[model samples]
Target: MGACVGCGGSQSPGVFVLEAGTYARCDGCGLASLDPLPAEGAAGALFEEGYFHGGVAGGYSDYDADGALHEANARARWALVERHSGAPPASVLDVGCAVGTFLVEAQRRGAQVAGVDVSPWARAQAEQRHGIGVAASVEEVAARESGEFDVVTFFQSLEHVPRPDRLLAGACACLRPGGLVVIETWDAGSTVARVMGKAWQQMNPPTVLHLMGRPSLAALLGRAGFELVTVERTSKLVSVGLVLHILADKFPALLGWLGVLARRPWLARLTLRYRLGDLVTAVARKPLAVVGT
Candidate 1:
Protein backbone atom coordinates (compact mmCIF):
# COMPACT_ATOMS: atom_id res chain seq x y z
CA MET A 1 0.00 0.00 0.00
CA GLY A 2 2.96 2.29 0.37
CA ALA A 3 3.46 2.29 -3.38
CA CYS A 4 1.16 3.82 -5.92
CA VAL A 5 -0.97 1.22 -7.68
CA GLY A 6 -1.04 3.49 -10.74
CA CYS A 7 2.60 4.43 -11.12
CA GLY A 8 4.68 2.51 -8.55
CA GLY A 9 5.64 5.71 -6.78
CA SER A 10 6.40 5.86 -3.06
CA GLN A 11 3.52 6.95 -0.85
CA SER A 12 3.42 9.06 2.32
CA PRO A 13 0.91 9.11 5.12
CA GLY A 14 -0.83 12.00 7.01
CA VAL A 15 -3.36 12.42 4.23
CA PHE A 16 -6.62 11.41 5.89
CA VAL A 17 -7.19 9.29 8.94
CA LEU A 18 -10.72 8.07 9.37
CA GLU A 19 -12.19 5.49 11.69
CA ALA A 20 -9.34 3.12 12.58
CA GLY A 21 -7.32 3.43 9.36
CA THR A 22 -5.12 5.82 7.41
CA TYR A 23 -5.29 6.81 3.72
CA ALA A 24 -1.90 7.26 2.11
CA ARG A 25 -1.49 9.36 -1.03
CA CYS A 26 1.04 8.60 -3.72
CA ASP A 27 3.78 11.15 -4.06
CA GLY A 28 3.85 10.83 -7.81
CA CYS A 29 0.22 10.63 -8.95
CA GLY A 30 -2.01 11.53 -5.96
CA LEU A 31 -3.53 8.08 -5.85
CA ALA A 32 -4.64 7.15 -2.34
CA SER A 33 -4.89 3.73 -0.80
CA LEU A 34 -5.53 2.18 2.55
CA ASP A 35 -2.23 2.27 4.40
CA PRO A 36 -1.35 -1.12 5.89
CA LEU A 37 -3.83 -2.71 3.51
CA PRO A 38 -5.33 -6.00 4.53
CA ALA A 39 -3.44 -9.15 3.56
CA GLU A 40 -4.17 -10.51 0.10
CA GLY A 41 -5.64 -13.69 1.56
CA ALA A 42 -7.82 -11.66 3.90
CA ALA A 43 -8.81 -9.21 1.18
CA GLY A 44 -9.77 -12.07 -1.11
CA ALA A 45 -12.24 -13.37 1.44
CA LEU A 46 -14.25 -10.14 1.29
CA PHE A 47 -15.86 -11.25 -1.99
CA GLU A 48 -17.92 -14.26 -0.92
CA GLU A 49 -21.62 -15.02 -0.80
CA GLY A 50 -21.98 -12.81 2.23
CA TYR A 51 -20.34 -9.93 0.42
CA PHE A 52 -23.12 -9.97 -2.17
CA HIS A 53 -25.76 -10.79 0.46
CA GLY A 54 -25.00 -8.32 3.25
CA GLY A 55 -22.17 -9.90 5.30
CA VAL A 56 -19.32 -7.46 4.62
CA ALA A 57 -18.72 -3.75 5.28
CA GLY A 58 -18.93 -2.63 1.64
CA GLY A 59 -20.96 -5.42 0.12
CA TYR A 60 -24.53 -5.23 -1.02
CA SER A 61 -27.58 -5.61 1.17
CA ASP A 62 -30.09 -7.93 -0.41
CA TYR A 63 -28.53 -7.49 -3.84
CA ASP A 64 -31.04 -9.72 -5.55
CA ALA A 65 -33.90 -8.01 -3.77
CA ASP A 66 -33.24 -4.87 -5.82
CA GLY A 67 -32.74 -6.59 -9.12
CA ALA A 68 -34.97 -4.16 -10.93
CA LEU A 69 -33.04 -1.18 -9.67
CA HIS A 70 -29.70 -2.76 -10.61
CA GLU A 71 -31.08 -3.47 -14.04
CA ALA A 72 -32.12 0.15 -14.42
CA ASN A 73 -28.73 1.35 -13.26
CA ALA A 74 -27.13 -1.03 -15.70
CA ARG A 75 -29.39 0.24 -18.44
CA ALA A 76 -28.24 3.79 -17.79
CA ARG A 77 -24.54 2.93 -17.42
CA TRP A 78 -24.30 0.86 -20.59
CA ALA A 79 -25.37 4.03 -22.37
CA LEU A 80 -22.35 5.80 -20.94
CA VAL A 81 -20.03 3.29 -22.57
CA GLU A 82 -21.94 3.20 -25.82
CA ARG A 83 -21.98 6.95 -26.22
CA HIS A 84 -18.20 6.99 -25.93
CA SER A 85 -17.49 3.80 -27.87
CA GLY A 86 -18.69 5.20 -31.26
CA ALA A 87 -20.59 1.94 -31.88
CA PRO A 88 -22.47 -0.62 -29.90
CA PRO A 89 -20.12 -3.36 -28.74
CA ALA A 90 -20.63 -6.79 -30.24
CA SER A 91 -18.92 -8.54 -27.30
CA VAL A 92 -18.17 -7.39 -23.75
CA LEU A 93 -16.09 -8.60 -20.80
CA ASP A 94 -16.77 -7.33 -17.32
CA VAL A 95 -14.12 -7.61 -14.59
CA GLY A 96 -15.29 -8.06 -11.01
CA CYS A 97 -18.81 -8.42 -12.35
CA ALA A 98 -20.61 -9.64 -9.27
CA VAL A 99 -23.73 -11.61 -10.14
CA GLY A 100 -23.47 -10.22 -13.69
CA THR A 101 -26.34 -7.78 -13.43
CA PHE A 102 -24.69 -5.43 -15.91
CA LEU A 103 -23.88 -8.20 -18.34
CA VAL A 104 -27.45 -9.39 -18.18
CA GLU A 105 -28.45 -5.93 -19.30
CA ALA A 106 -25.81 -5.85 -22.04
CA GLN A 107 -27.03 -9.17 -23.36
CA ARG A 108 -30.55 -7.76 -23.55
CA ARG A 109 -29.12 -5.03 -25.73
CA GLY A 110 -27.86 -7.76 -28.10
CA ALA A 111 -24.23 -8.16 -27.05
CA GLN A 112 -22.44 -11.37 -26.09
CA VAL A 113 -21.29 -10.80 -22.52
CA ALA A 114 -18.87 -12.58 -20.14
CA GLY A 115 -17.77 -11.81 -16.62
CA VAL A 116 -14.89 -12.32 -14.15
CA ASP A 117 -15.74 -12.27 -10.47
CA VAL A 118 -14.11 -13.79 -7.39
CA SER A 119 -17.30 -14.85 -5.61
CA PRO A 120 -18.57 -18.34 -6.30
CA TRP A 121 -22.06 -17.36 -5.28
CA ALA A 122 -21.89 -14.37 -7.60
CA ARG A 123 -20.75 -16.51 -10.51
CA ALA A 124 -23.46 -19.07 -9.81
CA GLN A 125 -26.12 -16.40 -9.62
CA ALA A 126 -24.98 -14.85 -12.86
CA GLU A 127 -24.92 -18.13 -14.76
CA GLN A 128 -27.89 -19.88 -13.23
CA ARG A 129 -30.23 -16.93 -13.11
CA HIS A 130 -29.19 -15.18 -16.30
CA GLY A 131 -27.04 -17.67 -18.23
CA ILE A 132 -24.18 -15.18 -18.43
CA GLY A 133 -20.74 -16.76 -18.68
CA VAL A 134 -18.78 -16.10 -15.51
CA ALA A 135 -15.19 -16.94 -14.56
CA ALA A 136 -12.99 -16.45 -11.53
CA SER A 137 -10.26 -14.34 -13.16
CA VAL A 138 -9.24 -12.56 -16.32
CA GLU A 139 -6.44 -15.08 -16.89
CA GLU A 140 -8.90 -17.97 -16.84
CA VAL A 141 -11.16 -16.18 -19.31
CA ALA A 142 -8.17 -15.26 -21.50
CA ALA A 143 -6.94 -18.88 -21.61
CA ARG A 144 -10.04 -20.05 -23.45
CA GLU A 145 -10.59 -16.86 -25.45
CA SER A 146 -7.88 -14.43 -26.47
CA GLY A 147 -8.39 -10.86 -27.78
CA GLU A 148 -11.98 -11.16 -28.84
CA PHE A 149 -13.92 -8.74 -26.61
CA ASP A 150 -14.93 -5.37 -27.97
CA VAL A 151 -15.34 -3.70 -24.62
CA VAL A 152 -14.28 -4.51 -21.03
CA THR A 153 -16.11 -2.95 -18.10
CA PHE A 154 -15.34 -2.57 -14.40
CA PHE A 155 -18.36 -1.01 -12.76
CA GLN A 156 -17.68 -0.19 -9.14
CA SER A 157 -15.22 -3.09 -9.07
CA LEU A 158 -11.77 -1.61 -9.67
CA GLU A 159 -11.33 -0.26 -6.14
CA HIS A 160 -12.01 -3.67 -4.62
CA VAL A 161 -8.83 -5.16 -6.08
CA PRO A 162 -5.38 -4.94 -4.51
CA ARG A 163 -3.67 -4.03 -7.75
CA PRO A 164 -5.71 -1.87 -10.12
CA ASP A 165 -2.88 -1.51 -12.63
CA ARG A 166 -2.29 -5.25 -12.82
CA LEU A 167 -6.02 -5.78 -13.10
CA LEU A 168 -6.10 -3.40 -16.09
CA ALA A 169 -3.37 -5.46 -17.77
CA GLY A 170 -5.40 -8.60 -17.26
CA ALA A 171 -8.45 -6.87 -18.69
CA CYS A 172 -6.63 -5.76 -21.84
CA ALA A 173 -5.35 -9.29 -22.38
CA CYS A 174 -8.84 -10.19 -23.65
CA LEU A 175 -9.53 -7.06 -25.66
CA ARG A 176 -9.22 -6.88 -29.43
CA PRO A 177 -7.12 -4.00 -30.72
CA GLY A 178 -8.98 -0.69 -30.39
CA GLY A 179 -11.37 -2.27 -27.89
CA LEU A 180 -12.57 -0.03 -25.09
CA VAL A 181 -11.99 -0.32 -21.36
CA VAL A 182 -14.70 1.24 -19.23
CA ILE A 183 -14.45 1.80 -15.48
CA GLU A 184 -16.72 3.13 -12.76
CA THR A 185 -15.48 3.71 -9.21
CA TRP A 186 -15.11 6.21 -6.39
CA ASP A 187 -13.40 9.50 -7.16
CA ALA A 188 -11.39 10.83 -4.24
CA GLY A 189 -11.14 14.29 -5.73
CA SER A 190 -14.86 14.79 -6.05
CA THR A 191 -16.30 17.79 -4.28
CA VAL A 192 -18.48 15.84 -1.88
CA ALA A 193 -15.61 13.56 -1.01
CA ARG A 194 -13.41 16.52 -0.22
CA VAL A 195 -16.16 18.10 1.84
CA MET A 196 -16.87 14.89 3.69
CA GLY A 197 -13.17 14.62 4.51
CA LYS A 198 -12.64 11.52 6.61
CA ALA A 199 -16.35 10.85 6.63
CA TRP A 200 -16.52 10.03 2.92
CA GLN A 201 -18.27 6.71 2.44
CA GLN A 202 -15.72 5.46 -0.08
CA MET A 203 -12.91 5.85 2.48
CA ASN A 204 -13.65 2.39 3.85
CA PRO A 205 -10.29 0.71 3.62
CA PRO A 206 -9.32 -2.87 2.97
CA THR A 207 -12.72 -3.12 1.30
CA VAL A 208 -11.71 -0.39 -1.17
CA LEU A 209 -7.99 -0.63 -1.93
CA HIS A 210 -7.60 2.61 -3.85
CA LEU A 211 -9.23 6.04 -3.59
CA MET A 212 -8.54 6.97 -7.23
CA GLY A 213 -9.46 10.20 -8.94
CA ARG A 214 -9.48 11.23 -12.60
CA PRO A 215 -5.76 11.81 -12.92
CA SER A 216 -4.69 8.64 -11.17
CA LEU A 217 -7.16 6.60 -13.16
CA ALA A 218 -5.88 8.18 -16.35
CA ALA A 219 -2.33 7.42 -15.25
CA LEU A 220 -3.22 3.78 -14.66
CA LEU A 221 -4.86 3.61 -18.09
CA GLY A 222 -1.73 5.03 -19.74
CA ARG A 223 0.42 2.50 -17.93
CA ALA A 224 -1.82 -0.28 -19.27
CA GLY A 225 -1.37 0.91 -22.89
CA PHE A 226 -4.84 2.43 -23.10
CA GLU A 227 -5.52 5.85 -24.53
CA LEU A 228 -7.78 7.75 -22.19
CA VAL A 229 -11.17 8.41 -23.76
CA THR A 230 -13.56 9.95 -21.27
CA VAL A 231 -13.79 10.43 -17.53
CA GLU A 232 -16.89 11.97 -15.99
CA ARG A 233 -19.18 11.85 -13.01
CA THR A 234 -21.91 9.29 -13.42
CA SER A 235 -25.36 8.76 -11.98
CA LYS A 236 -26.90 5.82 -10.13
CA LEU A 237 -30.35 4.64 -9.13
CA VAL A 238 -30.36 2.68 -5.84
CA SER A 239 -32.86 1.37 -3.35
CA VAL A 240 -33.36 2.55 0.22
CA GLY A 241 -32.45 -0.85 1.58
CA LEU A 242 -29.15 -0.68 -0.27
CA VAL A 243 -28.39 2.52 1.60
CA LEU A 244 -29.04 0.83 4.92
CA HIS A 245 -26.88 -2.08 3.82
CA ILE A 246 -23.98 0.27 3.16
CA LEU A 247 -24.44 1.99 6.51
CA ALA A 248 -24.60 -1.32 8.38
CA ASP A 249 -20.83 -1.40 8.66
CA LYS A 250 -20.25 1.71 10.83
CA PHE A 251 -23.53 1.00 12.62
CA PRO A 252 -23.85 -2.72 12.98
CA ALA A 253 -26.78 -2.11 15.28
CA LEU A 254 -28.78 -1.32 12.17
CA LEU A 255 -28.34 -4.79 10.75
CA GLY A 256 -31.08 -6.31 12.87
CA TRP A 257 -33.37 -3.37 12.13
CA LEU A 258 -32.27 -3.55 8.52
CA GLY A 259 -33.41 -7.14 8.30
CA VAL A 260 -36.73 -6.05 9.71
CA LEU A 261 -37.03 -3.13 7.29
CA ALA A 262 -35.99 -5.29 4.38
CA ARG A 263 -38.88 -7.57 5.17
CA ARG A 264 -41.22 -4.64 4.64
CA PRO A 265 -41.89 -4.73 0.92
CA TRP A 266 -42.74 -1.04 0.68
CA LEU A 267 -39.62 0.24 2.40
CA ALA A 268 -37.36 -2.13 0.52
CA ARG A 269 -38.80 -0.93 -2.78
CA LEU A 270 -37.88 2.72 -2.45
CA THR A 271 -35.25 3.89 -4.93
CA LEU A 272 -33.67 7.21 -5.77
CA ARG A 273 -31.84 8.49 -8.82
CA TYR A 274 -28.80 10.36 -7.65
CA ARG A 275 -25.82 12.21 -9.14
CA LEU A 276 -23.81 12.76 -6.00
CA GLY A 277 -20.66 13.31 -8.07
CA ASP A 278 -18.35 11.21 -5.88
CA LEU A 279 -18.30 8.47 -8.47
CA VAL A 280 -16.87 8.57 -11.99
CA THR A 281 -17.09 6.46 -15.13
CA ALA A 282 -14.01 6.31 -17.33
CA VAL A 283 -13.46 4.91 -20.81
CA ALA A 284 -10.15 4.17 -22.53
CA ARG A 285 -9.18 2.52 -25.79
CA LYS A 286 -6.55 -0.12 -26.48
CA PRO A 287 -4.24 0.67 -29.37
CA LEU A 288 -4.54 -1.00 -32.79
CA ALA A 289 -0.83 -1.81 -32.84
CA VAL A 290 1.37 -3.65 -30.34
CA VAL A 291 5.13 -4.31 -30.36
CA GLY A 292 4.92 -8.11 -30.34
CA THR A 293 2.02 -8.40 -32.76
Candidate 2:
Protein backbone atom coordinates (compact mmCIF):
# COMPACT_ATOMS: atom_id res chain seq x y z
CA MET A 1 0.00 0.00 0.00
CA GLY A 2 1.25 3.46 -0.85
CA ALA A 3 -0.19 6.98 -0.81
CA CYS A 4 -2.33 8.10 -3.72
CA VAL A 5 -0.64 10.44 -6.13
CA GLY A 6 -3.61 12.76 -5.98
CA CYS A 7 -3.46 13.12 -2.20
CA GLY A 8 0.26 12.50 -1.77
CA GLY A 9 -0.56 9.85 0.78
CA SER A 10 -0.22 6.10 0.98
CA GLN A 11 -2.24 4.12 -1.53
CA SER A 12 -3.74 0.66 -1.76
CA PRO A 13 -4.96 -1.28 -4.75
CA GLY A 14 -8.58 -0.29 -3.92
CA VAL A 15 -10.20 1.46 -6.89
CA PHE A 16 -10.95 4.67 -4.96
CA VAL A 17 -7.55 6.08 -4.28
CA LEU A 18 -8.40 8.87 -1.90
CA GLU A 19 -4.72 8.85 -1.15
CA ALA A 20 -1.70 6.52 -1.20
CA GLY A 21 -0.58 3.80 1.19
CA THR A 22 -2.49 0.79 2.46
CA TYR A 23 -4.18 3.47 4.55
CA ALA A 24 -4.17 7.24 4.44
CA ARG A 25 -4.09 9.35 7.60
CA CYS A 26 -5.68 12.74 7.03
CA ASP A 27 -3.36 15.47 8.15
CA GLY A 28 -6.31 17.81 8.39
CA CYS A 29 -8.32 15.66 10.82
CA GLY A 30 -6.51 12.38 11.50
CA LEU A 31 -8.80 10.03 9.57
CA ALA A 32 -6.80 7.06 8.27
CA SER A 33 -8.27 5.03 5.46
CA LEU A 34 -7.68 2.33 2.85
CA ASP A 35 -7.12 4.31 -0.28
CA PRO A 36 -7.47 3.07 -3.87
CA LEU A 37 -10.64 1.21 -3.02
CA PRO A 38 -11.12 -2.27 -4.42
CA ALA A 39 -12.61 -2.23 -7.88
CA GLU A 40 -16.22 -1.13 -7.36
CA GLY A 41 -17.70 -4.41 -8.47
CA ALA A 42 -15.34 -6.46 -6.36
CA ALA A 43 -16.08 -4.60 -3.17
CA GLY A 44 -19.80 -4.42 -3.86
CA ALA A 45 -19.84 -8.12 -4.56
CA LEU A 46 -18.38 -8.82 -1.15
CA PHE A 47 -21.52 -7.32 0.36
CA GLU A 48 -23.67 -9.59 -1.77
CA GLU A 49 -27.13 -9.77 -0.26
CA GLY A 50 -26.67 -13.28 1.04
CA TYR A 51 -23.37 -12.57 2.72
CA PHE A 52 -24.95 -9.80 4.77
CA HIS A 53 -28.63 -10.66 5.07
CA GLY A 54 -29.20 -14.37 4.74
CA GLY A 55 -27.63 -17.59 5.95
CA VAL A 56 -26.56 -15.87 9.13
CA ALA A 57 -28.48 -18.55 11.01
CA GLY A 58 -26.42 -20.43 13.56
CA GLY A 59 -23.35 -18.56 12.43
CA TYR A 60 -24.21 -15.75 14.84
CA SER A 61 -23.99 -17.90 17.96
CA ASP A 62 -26.68 -19.63 20.01
CA TYR A 63 -28.14 -17.50 22.79
CA ASP A 64 -26.28 -15.90 25.66
CA ALA A 65 -23.52 -14.23 23.67
CA ASP A 66 -26.05 -12.90 21.24
CA GLY A 67 -28.04 -11.22 23.97
CA ALA A 68 -24.92 -9.92 25.65
CA LEU A 69 -23.59 -8.29 22.49
CA HIS A 70 -26.95 -6.75 21.75
CA GLU A 71 -27.34 -5.46 25.27
CA ALA A 72 -23.86 -3.99 25.26
CA ASN A 73 -24.53 -2.24 22.01
CA ALA A 74 -27.76 -0.90 23.44
CA ARG A 75 -25.85 0.59 26.31
CA ALA A 76 -23.60 2.36 23.84
CA ARG A 77 -26.60 3.82 22.08
CA TRP A 78 -28.11 4.93 25.34
CA ALA A 79 -24.90 6.70 26.22
CA LEU A 80 -24.94 8.51 22.92
CA VAL A 81 -28.53 9.52 23.47
CA GLU A 82 -27.65 10.98 26.79
CA ARG A 83 -24.83 12.96 25.29
CA HIS A 84 -27.00 14.31 22.52
CA SER A 85 -30.17 15.25 24.36
CA GLY A 86 -29.66 14.29 27.96
CA ALA A 87 -32.42 11.94 26.86
CA PRO A 88 -33.38 10.07 23.73
CA PRO A 89 -33.92 11.97 20.52
CA ALA A 90 -37.52 12.11 19.34
CA SER A 91 -36.67 10.43 16.04
CA VAL A 92 -33.71 8.31 15.07
CA LEU A 93 -32.11 6.61 12.07
CA ASP A 94 -29.54 3.87 12.36
CA VAL A 95 -27.56 3.22 9.21
CA GLY A 96 -26.58 -0.39 8.65
CA CYS A 97 -28.30 -1.26 11.86
CA ALA A 98 -27.94 -5.03 12.04
CA VAL A 99 -30.86 -6.83 13.62
CA GLY A 100 -32.04 -3.51 15.09
CA THR A 101 -30.49 -3.93 18.50
CA PHE A 102 -29.70 -0.28 18.93
CA LEU A 103 -32.89 0.84 17.27
CA VAL A 104 -34.88 -1.41 19.54
CA GLU A 105 -33.24 0.10 22.57
CA ALA A 106 -33.78 3.58 21.23
CA GLN A 107 -37.45 2.79 20.66
CA ARG A 108 -37.80 1.61 24.20
CA ARG A 109 -36.25 4.89 25.23
CA GLY A 110 -39.08 6.71 23.46
CA ALA A 111 -37.53 7.54 20.13
CA GLN A 112 -39.44 6.94 16.90
CA VAL A 113 -36.82 4.76 15.29
CA ALA A 114 -36.12 3.65 11.76
CA GLY A 115 -33.22 1.75 10.28
CA VAL A 116 -31.59 1.21 6.88
CA ASP A 117 -29.48 -1.71 5.82
CA VAL A 118 -28.41 -3.28 2.57
CA SER A 119 -28.93 -6.83 3.69
CA PRO A 120 -32.45 -8.09 3.16
CA TRP A 121 -31.92 -10.85 5.66
CA ALA A 122 -30.80 -8.50 8.34
CA ARG A 123 -33.70 -6.18 7.59
CA ALA A 124 -36.18 -9.00 7.88
CA GLN A 125 -34.79 -10.12 11.19
CA ALA A 126 -34.73 -6.59 12.57
CA GLU A 127 -38.32 -6.00 11.56
CA GLN A 128 -39.56 -9.36 12.77
CA ARG A 129 -37.64 -9.39 15.99
CA HIS A 130 -37.50 -5.71 16.93
CA GLY A 131 -40.52 -4.29 15.14
CA ILE A 132 -38.50 -1.40 13.78
CA GLY A 133 -39.18 0.16 10.39
CA VAL A 134 -36.53 -0.91 7.93
CA ALA A 135 -35.42 0.26 4.50
CA ALA A 136 -33.28 -1.55 1.94
CA SER A 137 -30.99 1.38 1.29
CA VAL A 138 -30.03 4.70 2.81
CA GLU A 139 -30.92 6.59 -0.33
CA GLU A 140 -34.37 5.09 -0.38
CA VAL A 141 -34.98 5.95 3.23
CA ALA A 142 -33.56 9.44 2.93
CA ALA A 143 -35.60 10.08 -0.17
CA ARG A 144 -38.76 9.05 1.60
CA GLU A 145 -38.31 11.65 4.29
CA SER A 146 -36.24 14.81 4.43
CA GLY A 147 -34.95 16.29 7.69
CA GLU A 148 -36.71 13.49 9.50
CA PHE A 149 -34.18 12.35 12.03
CA ASP A 150 -33.06 13.80 15.29
CA VAL A 151 -30.25 11.33 15.58
CA VAL A 152 -28.40 9.38 12.89
CA THR A 153 -25.93 6.72 13.78
CA PHE A 154 -23.46 4.51 11.93
CA PHE A 155 -22.20 2.01 14.40
CA GLN A 156 -19.33 0.09 12.88
CA SER A 157 -20.96 0.63 9.52
CA LEU A 158 -19.50 3.83 8.09
CA GLU A 159 -16.24 2.13 7.21
CA HIS A 160 -18.07 -0.17 4.82
CA VAL A 161 -19.49 2.57 2.63
CA PRO A 162 -17.54 3.32 -0.59
CA ARG A 163 -17.90 7.08 -0.62
CA PRO A 164 -18.08 8.20 2.98
CA ASP A 165 -18.22 11.86 2.00
CA ARG A 166 -21.39 11.33 0.05
CA LEU A 167 -22.85 9.12 2.73
CA LEU A 168 -22.22 11.72 5.40
CA ALA A 169 -23.65 14.42 3.25
CA GLY A 170 -26.80 12.42 2.75
CA ALA A 171 -27.00 11.83 6.46
CA CYS A 172 -26.64 15.51 7.10
CA ALA A 173 -29.48 16.19 4.73
CA CYS A 174 -31.66 13.62 6.42
CA LEU A 175 -31.18 15.00 9.90
CA ARG A 176 -33.15 17.79 11.49
CA PRO A 177 -31.36 20.75 12.96
CA GLY A 178 -29.39 19.91 16.10
CA GLY A 179 -29.49 16.24 15.14
CA LEU A 180 -26.60 14.06 16.11
CA VAL A 181 -24.52 11.72 13.94
CA VAL A 182 -22.87 9.16 16.11
CA ILE A 183 -20.20 6.92 14.59
CA GLU A 184 -18.50 3.98 16.15
CA THR A 185 -15.70 2.44 14.13
CA TRP A 186 -12.35 0.73 14.46
CA ASP A 187 -9.61 3.14 15.40
CA ALA A 188 -6.78 2.75 12.94
CA GLY A 189 -4.39 4.58 15.28
CA SER A 190 -5.12 2.33 18.23
CA THR A 191 -2.35 0.44 19.92
CA VAL A 192 -3.78 -2.84 18.71
CA ALA A 193 -3.62 -1.63 15.10
CA ARG A 194 0.00 -0.65 15.53
CA VAL A 195 0.85 -3.91 17.25
CA MET A 196 -0.93 -6.07 14.72
CA GLY A 197 0.39 -4.05 11.77
CA LYS A 198 -0.82 -5.47 8.46
CA ALA A 199 -2.13 -8.44 10.35
CA TRP A 200 -4.71 -6.11 11.85
CA GLN A 201 -8.16 -7.31 11.02
CA GLN A 202 -9.32 -3.96 9.65
CA MET A 203 -6.32 -3.95 7.36
CA ASN A 204 -8.25 -6.38 5.20
CA PRO A 205 -7.40 -4.15 2.25
CA PRO A 206 -10.29 -4.48 -0.15
CA THR A 207 -13.18 -4.60 2.27
CA VAL A 208 -12.77 -1.89 4.88
CA LEU A 209 -13.00 1.14 2.59
CA HIS A 210 -11.71 3.58 5.17
CA LEU A 211 -9.72 3.19 8.40
CA MET A 212 -10.17 6.42 10.32
CA GLY A 213 -8.56 7.93 13.36
CA ARG A 214 -10.10 10.77 15.32
CA PRO A 215 -8.54 13.48 13.23
CA SER A 216 -9.60 12.09 9.91
CA LEU A 217 -13.08 11.44 11.20
CA ALA A 218 -13.41 14.96 12.54
CA ALA A 219 -12.29 16.35 9.21
CA LEU A 220 -14.75 14.22 7.31
CA LEU A 221 -17.53 15.16 9.67
CA GLY A 222 -16.65 18.82 9.39
CA ARG A 223 -16.61 18.57 5.64
CA ALA A 224 -20.09 17.12 5.79
CA GLY A 225 -21.35 20.00 7.96
CA PHE A 226 -21.02 18.39 11.35
CA GLU A 227 -19.32 19.66 14.45
CA LEU A 228 -17.30 17.45 16.71
CA VAL A 229 -19.27 17.33 19.91
CA THR A 230 -17.36 14.58 21.61
CA VAL A 231 -14.56 12.11 20.90
CA GLU A 232 -13.27 9.35 23.08
CA ARG A 233 -10.96 6.41 22.67
CA THR A 234 -13.10 3.58 23.88
CA SER A 235 -11.50 1.81 26.75
CA LYS A 236 -11.68 -1.40 24.74
CA LEU A 237 -8.69 -2.62 22.77
CA VAL A 238 -10.51 -2.34 19.42
CA SER A 239 -9.34 -5.85 18.54
CA VAL A 240 -12.30 -7.85 19.82
CA GLY A 241 -14.52 -7.74 16.75
CA LEU A 242 -11.55 -8.18 14.49
CA VAL A 243 -10.51 -11.17 16.55
CA LEU A 244 -13.95 -12.72 16.16
CA HIS A 245 -14.14 -11.85 12.46
CA ILE A 246 -10.73 -13.42 11.91
CA LEU A 247 -11.64 -16.55 13.79
CA ALA A 248 -14.83 -16.86 11.82
CA ASP A 249 -12.93 -16.49 8.56
CA LYS A 250 -9.90 -18.60 9.33
CA PHE A 251 -11.54 -21.29 11.38
CA PRO A 252 -15.16 -21.72 10.47
CA ALA A 253 -15.51 -24.93 12.40
CA LEU A 254 -14.74 -23.06 15.60
CA LEU A 255 -16.84 -19.99 14.86
CA GLY A 256 -20.16 -20.98 16.40
CA TRP A 257 -18.77 -22.19 19.69
CA LEU A 258 -16.39 -19.25 19.97
CA GLY A 259 -19.27 -16.89 19.45
CA VAL A 260 -20.87 -18.59 22.39
CA LEU A 261 -17.73 -18.25 24.44
CA ALA A 262 -17.70 -14.55 23.73
CA ARG A 263 -20.78 -14.32 25.93
CA ARG A 264 -19.43 -16.17 28.89
CA PRO A 265 -20.15 -13.93 31.87
CA TRP A 266 -16.53 -13.86 32.89
CA LEU A 267 -15.32 -13.33 29.35
CA ALA A 268 -17.99 -10.74 28.60
CA ARG A 269 -17.23 -8.71 31.68
CA LEU A 270 -13.54 -8.86 31.01
CA THR A 271 -13.98 -7.87 27.38
CA LEU A 272 -16.35 -5.00 28.05
CA ARG A 273 -14.54 -3.44 30.95
CA TYR A 274 -10.99 -4.36 30.11
CA ARG A 275 -11.40 -3.34 26.49
CA LEU A 276 -10.73 -6.97 25.77
CA GLY A 277 -11.31 -5.91 22.17
CA ASP A 278 -13.34 -2.77 21.56
CA LEU A 279 -12.11 0.44 19.85
CA VAL A 280 -13.31 4.02 19.39
CA THR A 281 -16.55 5.95 19.82
CA ALA A 282 -17.24 9.36 18.30
CA VAL A 283 -20.20 11.70 18.31
CA ALA A 284 -20.81 14.66 16.06
CA ARG A 285 -23.79 16.94 15.63
CA LYS A 286 -25.27 18.89 12.74
CA PRO A 287 -25.50 22.41 14.00
CA LEU A 288 -29.01 23.70 14.42
CA ALA A 289 -27.93 26.25 11.87
CA VAL A 290 -25.95 25.37 8.79
CA VAL A 291 -23.74 27.96 7.10
CA GLY A 292 -26.67 29.45 5.21
CA THR A 293 -29.61 28.44 7.31
lDDT of 1 by residue, 1-293 (tens): 56788888898886878766788999888899888776543554678788777777777777878888888888887898788888889999989888888888888889998899877778888888888878888888888878999999999888877778878988888999999999998898899989977767787866887899988998999998899988888889888877876666656677788777877879867998767998789989999976785
Task: Tell me each candidate's TM-score.
Answer: 0.90, 0.74
- For each candidate, the alpha-carbon lDDT, in order, equals 0.83, 0.66
Write model 2 residue lDDT over 1-293, tens digit each, in one string.
44422233343243323222366554544555665455422434454444442223212323233466567757766775677666658888988787788887887778888888766667777878877768866677789888889888888788876667777888998898888888888877678877766655566545576777766677678878888888776542212433454556545699798778655545533343435333677788888874764
Best by lDDT: 1
Give stretches of model 1 more than 4 Å off: 38-42, 248-264, 290-293
In model 1, pairs of residues that clash are none
All candidates: CA RMSD (Å): 2.7, 5.8
The 10 consecutive residues of candidate 2 with the worst lDDT sum are 53-62
TM-score of 1: 0.90
